[model samples]
Target: MSADVVAGWGGGEAATASGKKTLWWRDAPSARLAALGVVAFLAYLGGTWAFPLLRYYRTPLLDLGKLLDHGVRGGLLYTAAAVVCLACYGLALRIASRSGARLGVILVFALLFSATLFFSYPWGAADLFDYAVIGKVLGQYELNPYVVTGVELAGEPWVDYAPWSDTTSAYGPLWTALAGAVSRLAGKGLLANLLAFKGVALAFHWLDILLIALCLRETRPDRVAAGVLFYAWNPLVLVETLANGHNDNIMLAGMLLAVWLALRGRMLAAMLPLAGAVLTKFWGGLLFPLIIAAGLREQPRSLWRRLAYLAVAALLFGGALALGWAPFWAEGQGAWAGFRLQLFTTSWPLVARLALERWLEPARAMALAQGLALGATAAYALARAVRVRRAELTEASYGLIFFYLAFGCAWFQPWYLIWLVGLAAASWDRERLGRAALFSALGLLSYLLYHFVWFGWGLDHFSIDGFRALAMAATVLPPGALWLARGCMANR
Candidate 1:
């Protein structure tokens, strides 16, 4: 594609009235869009800096809770700020999609966004605190975090802040060991440890950006800037990975690297990073079958050759897992305990359980709902896996993850959407990208239902059922309506 076409100028050339062709950067509309994106970044930065004032839990470092009086006013202010940030993110994404967007501009803005959030308090979730406590358990006390719960280390700083204090480490051994190393480097300071973990996440977040760009360049070269911007500027990704300090970015980086290598025809070399991703978080394992399918496409039509390929792939994958687990294997035999704790109902599953409770016992209702979700997810995965081609692997992975998050996941979190957004951006599927963007905005918005509506509005009669109903509507309605409208337009 020519520069003008790539820049979204539909004609042969973008020329001035003086009959001189204008450069893309010098075009009036491009400059305006760039300026608007800059303004959005600045606005988002200010909002992140202000997050400390809305902190839910008191900390010795700073206490700005009184600024909003820690009541309904505070909640409403938080809701407003979140809404503005998401709106700004959406606008910036629109600007990035224009093909006129420069990679340099996107990279600079992404770096600034990550840096600002790196210093902000994790107001959205307490997962960072849990990570710090687990790190302390393993690093400071020299205990196996996978075997010992944070609750056992009662007096440790930040232990009280962890929501899952009674559970063992839910993350994979590789993440646990990395967290321990970060904790050891940071020493005994609470703030230091927290920032250290965020710093690691920041590094991985950038790695993910690089990997996303490289993958797009390999598969969808024309969309590199737009695709990178899609994942980099996503509000949910920023808040969850950078500010909240979730390790999902690390997992994503490994997955992206695997995809990049596989796209370049190094299918065997991709298995190591794919294994690393799974060892970072179990969800990364979902892509294994997809990768295998892609690998099979590259193999010659011979039973012995395909068998040899499968054996080598499995050996690489299993060997990586074994090496990652070897250090903690002896004492961390109960690591699966943390994974089991993550199986509680939320989102769509919660809605299902609530609806079924009218006719059956509560436990039975939940069991039935979970079973149905599993069955549906398994069927979808099988169908997609069977038809996946090497070129369509990323899109297939995105579709499976999107479907699971929508209808199967028993415990859904907003950060989980990062998985879908990352793959969708790589695939560069317009409809999937649109849906991912919509879901991201809505997922962030759903926070208000918990932080404000349920608590701030003084709705004493509000129940989990009410929250589930509103969350489901907020998540499902907008995208469903958009999909229907697009179908009607196509038919017309």
Candidate 2:
């Protein structure tokens, strides 16, 4: 109504608003990083998809000559992909000090696009044939996959490439049911399991990124975009969940949704998804104690109420688990197979074998090793929570996550990192993300090495020790040095 108001809206105040943005946003490091993050992520997805397809298939179309050529070509592509993931990571960090959310968005779209293209490819879908085996066991013959192995149905060209095809999933019974249905629907056709299982994994992986972003937003609105970048563009998640084909995606999505619900004070709504998650991955059981601890924050509720609520939820999960797994219990003879000596999916099992051989008595070796490893892990988790109970940072709870992920003596797979990727991203600081990103990329080596180990070339698998050593140095050294500069402020 006033001339001054009109002037302010049309000219003078508008100028002030525009100037303020140039000063804070354009020059703002975080904003720049956020924008770049989105671009880099999409680029990573694109660059990765641009490479060779790693699917397992027995195409009558390709003979030994073709096989050799494809292998050589695939090798180069994977290497280039690794390089691309790393380069983008560097760019992300350079811009991270400017714009985390923008960077994250870039990274997310890139990685997702990369994964999408990879799966959609004819060759890329080959690696997923093993799932078809499971489907055949369930769909065609009505036999339980837990009771069978891909090796049993090994007539296909694709099964040759699914390194873990001979191995059973150790997945929750219900997951097998779903895989079987896909196989049945595809019906003894070529690449049926591959197409179906990959489709499921693809759906879940997308859901995982979206849910993780939502959880981060709900709990720490400041870090939402960054969390999405970390999970989506993350090399480990890409290789394992998207490429190698892991089922952890669905399980983790459920877990993130549960966290979101609980954080929003809808604890009751959280329980179903949490229980379902546990059924998908037994590791979800760890949330019981953490949730219990979180509930203790309110005055007058006390630890007893916390434990009681946890018990209720545990019972809730336990009941669902019993029902879900009851049908497959008799079929899961190898259910707990391959679950020995795993530690952070690092080199723990290797270390354990060497250590046990030197000192422990053979009669007592296995039991003692398992006990000590499991006990120490649990103790560390409890200790960490107690120490950080007063810390203002919500990400501090990651101590428990890191500990659990590190304890087992099984072989490490890359996408397993997705479990904690969200936490790391939500709390990501100006420190270089390149190292962790490198570790994520090297995880792809597991695919190549897995083939070597399975066909009786465990010796050859370790031949990459030279590369492993280099990768370790590259992934850890820079970050370690950066920590010294800031006194490692993550806790603060």
- lDDT winner among the candidates? 1
lDDT of 2: 0.53
How many clashing pairs does model 2 include? 47
- Model 1 agreement with the true structure over 265-362: per-residue lDDT tens digits: 88889999999998898778877888888899789999999999999999999999999988887654665754563365346677777889999998
Write down the worst ten-residue block by lDDT for model 1: 60-69
lDDT by residue (1-492, candidate 2, tens digit) is: 121221121121111223342222343444455455455555555544443344434442322224335354555554565566656655654443233334323443555554564553332223355556666677777776666667776475445555556766556666777877887787766655555676787788778767765665555555554455566666666656665566777777767776666677655556678777777766665554555455455325576776777677667766877888777776436435434333222344334544675787743555565566667767765665454432222354344554444444234455666666655554454332343444455554444433323223334444343334333333333433444445556657
lDDT of each: 0.76, 0.53
- Candidate 2 stretches with Cα past 4 Å from truth are 1-56, 59-80, 93-97, 100-108, 120-127, 150-168, 296-299, 302-308, 331-346, 361-367, 385-397, 406-409, 426-438, 441-492
Give the residue spans of candidate 1 off by over 4 A.
1-25, 53-72, 330-342, 476-492
The TM-score that candidate 1 achieves is: 0.88
lDDT for model 1, please.
0.76
Model 1: per-residue Cα lDDT at residue 38: 74
Q: Estimate each model's TM-score.
A: 0.88, 0.72
